[model samples]
Target: MSNQVCAPALAIRRCCSDDVHHMLPLMRQLRYPTTPSVLKERLTMLEGHEQLCSLVAEVDGVVVGTIFLKQHQTHDMMKPVTSITALVVDEKHRGTGIGKRLLLEAETWGKERGSSQMFVSVAGDNNITSKSFYEYSGFTCTGYRLSKPLA
Candidate 1:
């Protein structure tokens, strides 16, 4: 007895709701809060806004990875920047270059949008593996966080 299978060639493209269902699970795997209600709100936001951007990675018409980018402007009035809020790839596809493609695509998208910088906020604890990935992908840690008490 044996199992047989075929791997589909991966392709990357702009996202649509059809890809959202698959993207949600990958989001959850990364500890991103996800529920029908939350996902619905996100999908609605994506559909209703031009400022929101997401890219999907597909294999044989199935979404296997995603990167979510939100455009933002500084209060000082400077060139727009993009915040990379989430990026995930199916566990089975990890390390196969799909995640890398999604990130590079995000950077390219930022460039196209005239973003002065791309930013991401991540937990402070060191996860060497994760840190290595970010560094390998050309992100640097700036080591700054500001907090102030609200009266």
Candidate 2:
């Protein structure tokens, strides 16, 4: 048989607590609402879950990006779906394939864990770059969010 293979452009791995420090700056740069303490807490929670996948993209011993996928327990007419959250890449490394790598890793993890669909929440008009990125990455815009202040 001929050798046919698929390889990622960057190294992707499951993230550990040790990666929190490196990931913090990237998270902040992406304007995620998680503080360091909150991040640490979330990591701890993930460590205890069998259904959560936290992945990191690395280059030469440095962590450049992260993605988190959690399988939702809620069933939509008895069908399962996974929620993808907190995809972050350093600003300097944004378009260099790191984010994409992290996303692919997370999707693979979710698919392997029995999820048929992936979902992410994007701020309606605030994150143009992220909207473009998700669309470019092959996710269709399937929903919307609307809110009004309770004053």
Candidate 3:
């Protein structure tokens, strides 16, 4: 006999202001540290933006993952592109397909908005796990993302 524990049902939906408390820790896990108030403000701002799509994955009413996508048109691009600004799955649920589901939802959201391509920026060069996951999900590294801080 095979004995395998089943994972709880996952629910992915547009993030709302009330989700700040639940999403804060996930954001911290992704290296974005902020207070609940600040996170609430950010979530409110995202809610007011027409080009932004923020989604959260919930399991048994607890937020376990989130993805933030933005749609924009560049000077060089003929069609709008959807950029994945943030994606994080709780450490305990990392390998259970939450991230992938969130990503797929983001893609659907983008496509519904007429976006022709999807893009994501990985912060560090050595983040092999993230790179591998994206690659496995059909994303290819296109170019380097360089940043310079302003004084």
**Rank by lDDT, descending?**
3, 1, 2
lDDT of 3 at 56: 96
lDDT of 2 by residue, 1-151 (tens): 9898865456788887767788789877766777777888778777758878788888766888888888876745365678886788877778888878787877787778777888888884447889899899989997785678999
Candidate 2, residue 102: the lDDT equals 80
Query: TM-score of the candidate numbered 1?
Result: 0.80
**CA RMSD of each candidate after superposition:** 3.9, 5.5, 2.6
Cα lDDT for residue 60, model 3? 87
Evaluated with TM-score, which candidate comes out highest?
A: 3
> What lDDT would each prediction earn against the true structure?
0.80, 0.79, 0.90
Ranked by TM-score from best down, the candidates are: 3, 2, 1
Model 3 poorest ten-residue lDDT run: 121-130
Among these predictions, the greatest lDDT belongs to 3
Q: How does each model score on TM-score? A: 0.80, 0.81, 0.92
Global lDDT for candidate 3? 0.90
Candidate 1 regions exceeding 4 Å error are 1-7, 124-126, 144-151
TM-score of 3: 0.92
**Mind giving the per-residue lDDT tens digits that candidate 1 earns over 1-151?**
7797877788888876655577778877787778866776776678646568878899888888888899899986589888987777888888898989998898988888788888876653435666677888898988855667998
| Candidate 3 residue pairs that clash | none
Q: Write model 3 residue lDDT over 58-142, tens digit each, in one string.
A: 9988999999999999999888999999899999999998999999999999899889999998876437899899999999999
Error of 1 at 61 (Å): 2.0
lDDT of 3 at 127: 71
